[model samples]
Target: MAEPSPPSFPPGNYDLSSVDLDDDRYEVKQSAIRNKYTIRDSTGNVVLRGKQKMFKMKEEFPFVTDNGEDAFTVKAGGIMDVTGNYAITDTGTSEEVIILGEDFSLFVENWTIRDPDTGEALATIQSKSGFSRPSDTLSPL
Candidate 1:
């Protein structure tokens, strides 16, 4: 079967200039054992860091800033949950940003991000083959 054409957006319809840019670029470095990950910037300055510890029941990974301030955390859920089942929370306000779940199909595997409060889908990401080109425009779901 022929593949569907990629979606397109008209020119000047969206303003790309006013979008906020991330000033600090983070580079993640993981240890050989995958127990620790350090985030550094372009100048080799540590910006954020994370550490994980193994346990019998559950495992939790917390990411912190250079000053040892709590940034966010990821905690594993029960085994009965889906593949991407985990709880991710922001440490500052104690708000959950994204709860991930996986959906499998015959041709694609989808990773969905849902709102923790209402359980509504916020975004869906699908794995694509390396030879496939990305669409130039994005539309709201």
Candidate 2:
């Protein structure tokens, strides 16, 4: 028999391949102090969990699979990096898979997702409106 899932993750056989290819809609939840975040699929199942320290000059978010295995790590730009970009590193390969660059804006945050190795743009995650951050990871999917 297999070991039971951890309390941090929901119970089920989480397939990362399914999450990467099939899933189109995912709800992202964040903690109030801006330290942790959880991503859920359209079926309202927790797919990924990420956390970082509450206070840091440069933040680093270590993400894990639903089964609590290492998945990826997102490191924020250093103090000298004016763009305030974030690099997503694949834990297994130890390579930067994606780069999220914060575009300067007067009112909202605009992020560009890029291919880290090739330096090619992939997609963009723009803040449509002011996000009313929740304290916990409980929201409608």
Candidate 3:
């Protein structure tokens, strides 16, 4: 598969350039007891950390940089995405930039990264080997 292009974001408070998207080898470590998670590089440097509020009618995860700057958020709310579809929004502008939705597969875990506006499939992510998808493009985003 070709490298999956990230979803386009309009001019707003959302800034992708501020993020360290240079490395795709970062690992995600989730807290077993809660919704908190930390993203670390292969060398074990914390990249980004985030958590969601408990007891919400809908699920949302807001992430921030190690320096504590708001980065982005993953939200599941709209009628069209209330089930397995999620919107990754820019926290500063509250604009939905991308979507992660569940796509059915017979044997393995299947999911997709999509454009929230056009509903175009940007990438198909499968659990080929525990997050070892063919392309590591989506990791830093």
Which segments of candidate 1 are over 4 A away from where they belong?
Answer: 1-21, 42-44, 79-82, 100-114, 118-141
Where model 3 places Cα greater than 4 Å from the true spot, the runs are 1-17, 78-83, 104-109, 127-141
Write one digit per residue (lDDT tens) for candidate 2, span 46-118. 8889887655556676888788888888887774343567888778767676688877655555677776666
Q: After superposition, how far is residue 119 of candidate 3 from its true place, in Å?
A: 1.6
lDDT tens per residue, model 3, 19-88: 6555545566556545588988878888789986765556677888889988888777553232378788
**lDDT of candidates 1 onward, in order:** 0.56, 0.64, 0.65
Which model is ahead, 1 or 3, in terms of lDDT? Answer: 3
- Which candidate number maximizes lDDT? 3
- Report residue 27 deviation for candidate 1 (angstroms): 3.3
User: Listing every candidate in turn, what is its Cα RMSD in Å to the true structure after a full C-alpha superposition?
Assistant: 11.2, 11.1, 7.1
Question: How well is each residue in 1-141 modelled by candidate 1, as lDDT tens digits?
Answer: 985443332343211222211333445555644447887776787877778765324546787777787778876566323244667777765666667776644444466767676777766666553321112011000
Candidate 1 CA-lDDT value: 0.56
Worst 10 residues of 2 by lDDT: 132-141
Off by over 4 Å in 2: 1-21, 80-83, 128-141
Worst 10 residues of 3 by lDDT: 132-141
Residue pairs with backbone overlap in model 1:
none
